[model samples]
Target: MRHRYGFTDEACAFFDFFAAPAPELADRTLTALQHALDTATLDHPRALRYGRLLQAYELMFWEGLREG
Candidate 1:
């Protein structure tokens, strides 16, 4: 399924990674996201911008699921 925010590869990877329930998988996902955010290059500003946006979207999505 395509995501509402935008179906980029990163978003698809995130959704696929989280489709199954596993504590270690969550840790791995967080680690991968942090690495991407930390290493995004200024030369490619869109990488950083999109990374942050996706991060925000993921947070909001989990928050909404928790609330609901």
Candidate 2:
């Protein structure tokens, strides 16, 4: 997938992060996402570029849960 996107070698590792096992938190997937975003920021500063997108994902996830 990284190759398909033409991401550089350094960025390949950042893309690999999506393969990590989803963090488990019972009914708090939002918290899990927060944790992921934090870890991504720490693990790959470049991830900062996606902070807003990640926040959007978190919002959408919470909305889905609320409407569930």
Candidate 3:
């Protein structure tokens, strides 16, 4: 079956994160996102730009996942 929108491997990897009964992927995602936000703030001089980008990606991920 073809979906109107589709997910890539990297996104599936991230979305499958909350499936476990533990916190490994979630923890890693949190840490990575936090670092990205901080780095973007210091390097890009844009407040919350990286965070917003990540949020946009997450939103798009959910949209694609649910499109099937």
Candidate number of the best TM-score:
1
Task: List clashing residue pairs in candidate 2.
Answer: none
- The RMSD (Cα, Å) of candidate 2 is 14.2
What C-alpha RMSD separates each model from the true structure? 11.2, 14.2, 7.8
lDDT of each: 0.75, 0.64, 0.66
- What is the Cα-based lDDT of residue 27 in candidate 3? 93
What TM-score would each prediction reach against the true structure?
Answer: 0.39, 0.30, 0.38
Most lDDT-accurate candidate: 1
Q: What is the per-residue lDDT of model 2 for residues 1-68, given as tens digits with 9 covering 90 to 100?
A: 45565778676675355446556644485676579787774444545557678879967976895697
Supply the TM-score for candidate 2: 0.30
Q: Which is the better candidate, 1 or 3, if ranked by lDDT?
A: 1
lDDT string for model 3 (1-68, tens) is 11434866675675466545464768986787699777774444454687688779977877896795
In candidate 1, position 18 carries an lDDT of 80
Two-way TM-score contest, 1 vs 3, winner: 1
Off by over 4 Å in 3: 1-15, 19-47
Determine which window of 10 residues in candidate 3 has minimal summed lDDT.
Answer: 1-10
